[model samples]
Target: MGRIAAGDGESYARSISTSSNVEIRRRTRVTDIAQRVAKLMWQWAAHIVRRKDGRWGPKVLEWQPRTGKRSVGRPPKRWTDDIKRVAGIR
Candidate 1:
């Protein structure tokens, strides 16, 4: 930018460099943000798979040494719910 502003025939170079964001979307071209978004959504769905111990974590029942105790109350929003909301799943 400095070099372009200081000399003639350099403004073109500066403008081209600055306008690249609009000309090319890096997320869609390189990494493909849509794919990453889907992967994340599936991970969220996996989070809702219940276990026999009344937990939202591991699928295996009593597979770990962690306590499976529950409180006498309602539960919070499930990941599956959010996943459905975002992906528009009924």
Candidate 2:
């Protein structure tokens, strides 16, 4: 094992194998690529849904309850106004 300086200027211990380090780096890259692809897929799916019904789809935006506020278990439904505008819905 070896210690390396982290972004926060703290030394963290990690495995000393070169192969392990390479695998970790590869996994990180793969995760980033997956995230990008997922975002693109979501946008395409949302576009298709909106085009089919002239209305925003369920996945376009999600509503979350206000922080530190009491409310029902389900958060209020909301739309992404920005996305709506981009989609020229309204």
Candidate 3:
């Protein structure tokens, strides 16, 4: 009778061990999939933002006078000498 009880206990222990291993493998696979999805989302968002922003094309500006003869308008989009000077670039 004692030997039979010991065999039952060993079988229960083995079952628990196998179940734990299966659970661990399932969790690892889920984590790997989530990481892959996150990386793809980041890349897609960056691409969309870049497309919305204007590319490296030339821009034309029209100058006009503001109140009290003050010359004010949207500056030229092209990088100019003044911009380089202020930027401390030679």
Best of the candidates, TM-score: 1
lDDT of 2 at 79: 44
Top candidate on lDDT is 1
Give per-residue CA lDDT, model 2, range 1-90, as digits (tens). Answer: 244446633323323243574487686665566567757866775666667554555434554446896675965544455446546886
The list of candidate 3 runs beyond 4 A from truth reads 1-31, 53-90
lDDT of 2: 0.56
TM-score per candidate: 0.32, 0.26, 0.26
lDDT, candidate 1, residue 88? 94
Ten-residue stretch with the least lDDT total in model 3: 56-65
> Candidate 2: how large is its RMSD?
10.7
Clashing pairs in 2: none
The worst-scoring run of ten residues by lDDT in candidate 1 lies at 56-65
RMSD of 3: 16.2
For each candidate, the alpha-carbon lDDT, in order, equals: 0.58, 0.56, 0.52
